[model samples]
Target: MKKPPIWFWQIALLVMIFIIWHIATSPDLIPPIFFDNEYRAAFFFGEPAKIFNAIWVWFMSGEIYPHLWVTLQETLLAFAIGTLLGLAVGLWLGLTPLASAILDPYIKAMNAMPRVILAPIFMVWFGLGIWSKVALGVTLVFFIVFFNVYQGVKEVSPVVLNNARMLGANASQLLRYVYLPSATSWVFSSLHTSVGMAFVGAVVGEYLGSAKGVGYLIHQAEGAFDINTVFAGILVLTVFALLLDFVVTFAENKLLKWRPQQAETETT
Candidate 1:
């Protein structure tokens, strides 16, 4: 037979994984070799069929939308605010050697600190609302963007800088034409990772304490020993995270159209 397309293989792999998971967790299908009871596997790992059913029930009941919306809102706000702040600060420090030197240790210290530890502190400061989650996410996202932007600005070609200066390019003109483009390119490169971090921060904050969010749903499920529902919540979050990453990739393609295509480079 002719070889299948890449997507077909990819989907086949995913289906195979689910099939194995289903078999491993189904009490009737798998014997209780590891556990004393036949149902122990299903009780602990959960049945894939039941997990899918739980997810279907959640969506059909329209009970998951509010939680999803809350998580999305927190992630977006954190991403936006963190990116802006990081870009601004990175530009300022990247362009100023003296300030950069002075603040280097402090910046490193802050980045080194465990950001998850700040979630509780943020909860205390911002209360148990979306703002707290947003704050935690900002901490996670800010450093990633900041470091990328900083490196991008610092890595600007010295030849290009000299040429711009020779052409009498003013500070504002250099920043607009050179610095911003370079920094934004790096920002886009890190966008996917930053988005994932944002999601993690939001969910973790919700898991710790919140009235609404997919994380809150997972937490509640855990409390009730509802492994199926917990897995359902994780599945929903994973799907949405992939969707968000797709959106980021779309935006990157649109914004970076000026960059040479990989196929064209390869052909050359």
Candidate 2:
């Protein structure tokens, strides 16, 4: 017999998970070993069918668009601003030994700090509007790209730098040709992670305080004990996050075609 395609297994796994989730959550579908009441299972875990239904209702009623748009705006703005700041600071510090040494301890301390606590401070400074959420997301995204770019610059071979210097390459020429290209790969490598962090920051900010966004929706659902709607909101965020990650991969492929391709494992 022929082997099934990889995608077949992927789809099958998702279907199986949904089936199990449905069974485990539907009242009377299974014994209430964990919960005192069979209804409590469905109440706490929520039924898969109802979760999907809640999503469908939100779309059909056209209620989720504005919220989604708000989240997308926050995420994109945060990603852009953070990436720019990271690129600039990383390039500067990575190139300047004195500056890097001066700020090394402070940079490490800031990166070590938990960013969630800063959300409240941002809310106070920027208010409950979109800027607060964007500010929170920038903090989340900045470090990842900063580290990657800094490392990339440091990774530039001394031999290559010497050759360029001997060839009379000026500072601007060396930066434009040597440093930027070396850092490009690292920047792209960090894109997926940084984008996800931006999404996380936006959602978290919205969860804490906001009148809009999917996180806001989930918060509202939680207050009302509407487990299905909460799950639906979560699902929406997850799906969009995945789509954004896919875009990053697609852009990487297009932009990095000049780079060597990795070998794929053959199924024998």
Error of 1 at 233 (Å): 0.8
Residue 3 C-alpha lDDT in model 2: 100
Under the 3 Å rule for N, CA and C atoms, how many clashes does model 2 have?
A: 0
TM-score of each: 0.96, 0.95
Model 1 global lDDT (CA atoms, 0 to 1): 0.94
- The candidate scoring highest on TM-score is 1
Residue pairs in candidate 2 whose N, alpha carbon or C atoms collide under 3 angstroms: none
Worst lDDT 10-window in candidate 2: 259-268
Model 2 C-alpha lDDT per residue in residues 1-268, reported as the tens digit of each score: 9999999999999999999999888887778878888899888888999999999999999999999999999999999999999998999999999999999999999999998899999999999989999999999899998999999999998999999999999999999999988888899999999999999999999999999999999999999999999989988998999999999999999998888778756778
Q: Which stretches of candidate 2 lie over 4 Å from their true place?
A: 264-268
Instruction: For residues 1-268, write the lDDT of model 1, one tens digit per residue.
Output: 9988999999999999999989988888868878899889889998899999999989999999999999999999999999999999999999999999999999999999998998888999999999999999999999999999999999999899889988999999999888999899999999999999999999999999999999999999999999999999999999999999999999999999987776764433
lDDT of each: 0.94, 0.94
Task: Supply the TM-score for candidate 1.
Answer: 0.96
